[model samples]
Target: MTRLDAVVVGAGPNGLSAAITLARAGLRVQVLESHAQVGGGLSSATLTLPGFVHDYGSAIHPLAAASPAFRTWPLHAFGLDWVQPDAPVVHPLDGGRSVTLERDLYATADGLGADGPAWIRLMKPLLDDWEGLLDDILRPLPRVPGHLLTLARFGIRGLPPADLLGRTLFRTPEARALWAGLAAHSILPLSTPGTSAMTLVLALLAHAVGWPFPRGGAQSLADALRAYLEFLGGEVITGVSVRDARDLPDARVVLVDSSPRVLLDILGERAPTAYREALTSYRYGPGIQKFDYALDGPVPWADSRVGRAATVHVGGTLEEVTASEAHLDSAVSDRPYVLTAQHSLFDPTRAPAGKHTFWAYAHVPGGSAVDVRPQVEAQLERFAPGFRDRVLACTVTTAPQLQAFSPVFHGGDVNGGRGDLWGLLSRPVPTATPYRTPVRSVYLCSSATPPGGGIHGMSGHHAALAALKDLFGVRRGE
Candidate 1:
């Protein structure tokens, strides 16, 4: 093959984004992926039976829809249609009661009982500056922020521990539990600082962008992105794993959209001593065991609204969620807090006629082999009775399985690395420039970079921009 201007290792959203960005810069760019198909985490398959499409990783996409980078590309033209539900999220309590995170702020707050006003008061500022806040926080932070006031407001009120936020702002268990469940997405302990930021960002997005996913499966979104990249003259090579630096093309610029450790492994001796030590010592949070269920019918949720919403948090009260998520020392909970999404309810293409698709995941110790299915079933049956009887088929993915499937998923720490207190600001290693590695003309564009996890792909976009300005002559605005 001819030498390319840029070679992006890994074809996840971040890799695709880097390749696409470089391609848009009028450079010859090639993306190499290990799997036959692209879209590392975004890929989907019929893990159960034919005709049932399930998302392999990301089920709900609020960050992707609102991303500054994705907004520039019209992915919808390439068969990416987002199906938004009536409510973005719903947290179920006992006795047929559930709280929905409606598109309208008041509508969501209204269900919080006595803490309804407090919920609104806490979220209103972030919602008011939703776009600005995302623009600042979506990428690396502590830079000269454009919206310093908005960032300041969010940081002051949103940086507390999940347990603290829940207890202080919410008078009712329902409201507090909802916050706890959303914050648990961080995979950090509830007592961990900066955990509350997840709740604030996710909650605001429910109203700001409306939590939605592609109609067919998450893979459809990836396909659309890849198609867009190809349209821009970028090339993607599949089934080619780049383990050593010798596997990469002789390119002017190289971007690795993998974990920091994987980048170190691929480049090895090429990376300097300091950078090598930093990446090797990188910390990861608890792993997640994801379950995809092909259901005979919709989940028989006690509260019908739980099925109506796109995502559901199945953990009980705030205290209960805290106890379940405190598995930092690598313990799995029998009554683990679980997040579930019944995609077929909103997007029928996910399953066959009358049949349904259920996606759920629970936190466990990194690389644990214990089966969390019984716990998952118990959680589902806790809110939705007789849930097991409706299952036509199910597939379980442990941390090791996810890691084997995609190297970037390091120990199934899906956020690339932990986004806890210290790890949040200084992920992949403490440096003002997270994307720029020790090696010149090489960058880390994966979630291991700044802004940590999610499907936003901003890390790739930013990394490509850095490569363009620092290596090439091209540049973009601040």
Candidate 2:
């Protein structure tokens, strides 16, 4: 057999990306996955009923669409087609009203009424040079940023708590509610310092590249990535688990796309005490209890405009959304904030004709086993009256179940680890190169590394570049 140059463990987006990077550098590479399929969070399945395709993890792909690494690749040629909705997001309010984040910046701002100018003033500068902003933010921090001025501008606005920024920037309830919903994606409290960072990114991506998903399902994106990897001469082997160093193939370097704890287990005694301690101390944020529904018909949303967007923020008002996320550690709220996506509305392939699929989830305490279906459905019914009547089938996935499916989602924290200020800076361990471990030939390439979470695959891309430069003396563009 030909000698392998690199081995990437776990066939998540990161793993596949690492393999593709190595193979592109003219090195032989292989990927191992425990699951039968790739796309750790990007995978889809028939969770509810036949012909109803529900995304197991992420439902929307604003980040994936705008990812610098992904944009440069030919995923489109390998069956990756984006399904963009008329609007990127719709935040429903009381009294049958809704606000939308449109693909056109002015349209979205115009809908905000009194807060229109504030909205443009806040986003226009960053949106103007979004490509440069993404390039600097999507990698490790504390380095010489390619766009120093842009990074500095983002930091000044993003360092404040989302709640503070939302109140201080926008006066209207519509704008404040929209900002709160976007900030809540962090899975951290809206009041948490640095929560505004993700809020800004998500909103910017809406205008930069309307929130989209693959034409068929998120799995199509993964399948396309795998196909592209094969085209690059890299191989992927599923149903293979790499538990420890002994299980890894003979290769010059290994990139791990699992959690920090899993990485420690793989390293065993080879990792020094200090490094092991750092990995052990890594903290995870709140988990989520997700729901997938096979509906008999479209959700009868109170405001008809809500149907225009695939992504819906179901929690009302800034105060309501803030309270819902604020008490995650104590108890699940009776009216919890729900992040919902109605994919069948835009993609016919998601369900049988006239039928629809609903993907929604609410943040719960870490490793929570409690079922929050009642609360989730109540939120849905609150916004979309008669919504319960349309449900053909429902599949509930608890937080623990999510962790069981993939170790990367440790304690069901989808972003991998906490995304707070400290969490982002010291992810796994504070270092110039978080992907590089104490072992020279081994590296960590999961969301546990820099640019934590979301499906961009920059974690894997940066890790592969590191290994390429160190092990093969191959830098990017070589």
Candidate 3:
């Protein structure tokens, strides 16, 4: 029986995005989610203690602030408010000395001393048309961008390896280390080709719009999206996993907010052999060993700025950061690079009064069950003395556990898939619209698509538009 016009098989940000789009276009949309709650990566819970709340998947949301798709939605009106820290990021060195990426471009430069001029010159052009620049970079490639020169200039800088660019452009260790920390977000080694693109865009995001988190945890953002969909007469069913398209209610179109692996399973024999092989051959990157801490007091950081920064890069200098990434590339290292966010420092709702919540993760070899907490804690303790003593309680989520929780984080590859040089452009498969799969009415709408990962929701938004234009003949606006 035809129960809905469309069915979204995952209620992650991407799934909800596609559901909302179709609902707004006057189609009956129903989202079926495996998890009990909505937000796929946006869910937050009291992981450590009764008072402490930690994000299960993503923590900081720089991409959300600049997403063209989110810009069109009135999510803020639906009770999604952002809370910003004093600074976007803090990179601490050996001693108490630290470098901060401030919200204001000039303020961030001021901390760089002599390299301030070079920083200003490098960032000025990008900041001028920040939104336009994001528009060009934050979507499927192969299409003509509105701003050709802006994208070309970005390509010139972003195309280079971050290691080379940092060494060539900046003289100081602080500048180079900051870039390394930012580029490490790519999950690729700093020496890799597209690594510079990750660093440039992340730094620009910090200087353009401060890295912020949703108030009352990321669930608020997901709830807001779900609420907006409901207002548009859409619905979602929880705890229902769609193992195959045949298992789902009859619908005109089905958008899967899942990884290529899950898509392969769902399609089964219905999938074309080439598409099945392509999805099967789709590469997943290194996994993550995550930790959440409930602290008795603020982390005793050597640098006071670390208290103000919502996100902290715990690895030491440029050379050290590069070495740590290389270690992840080959094997787990004792001194691993750690990406941390202490939102409870800025957002009070994350925990009870006095207690604080801290989220951190280190990249580990794919499908590795090894617990990297000791090393992660060691790294934190390296920068923040007395860090181990301050923890009231701690919770660890192994790579296997992450994959078990969400299939999209297959093998604990959180950013969807491997984002190497080719991983960025030809993610999953290279097509004008990466959303379309062999099954015409069935579209893949996950971070596995172009503009991979983080809480941007563009992959879902783009997939929905593609389905509308091609399948339903309805342009996104209409």
- C-alpha lDDT of residue 92 in model 2: 94
Which is the leading candidate under lDDT? 2
Estimate TM-scores for all models.
Answer: 0.98, 0.99, 0.98
lDDT scores of the candidates, listed in order: 0.87, 0.91, 0.87
* lDDT of predicted model 2: 0.91
Alpha-carbon shift of residue 200 in model 1 (angstroms): 0.3
The model with the greater TM-score, 2 or 3, is 2
* Backbone clash pairs in model 3 (N, Cα, C under 3 Å; residues 3+ apart or in different chains), count: 0
How many steric overlaps are in each model, in order?
0, 0, 0
TM-score of 2: 0.99
**Candidate 2 lDDT trough over 10 residues, lowest sum:** 139-148
Model 2 misplaced regions, further than 4 Å: none
Cα lDDT tens digits, model 2, 417-442, are: 98998888888898988889999899
**Order of all candidates by lDDT, from best down to worst?**
2, 1, 3
Q: Which tens-of-lDDT digit does each residue in 1-478 have in candidate 1?
A: 7878999999999999989899988999999998888899988889898999988998899999999998779898988898999888899999999877788989888877788899888888888888988999986765788888889988887789989978988888788888888888888889988888888899889989899988888998899989999999999999998988888889998899988878997778988898788888998877889999999999999988787787999899889889988865578777898988889998888898999999999988887868889988998899999999998989999999999988788888899888886887788877777888888888999998878899998999988988998998898863
Candidate whose TM-score is highest? 2
How well does candidate 3 match the true structure, expressed as C-alpha RMSD? 1.2
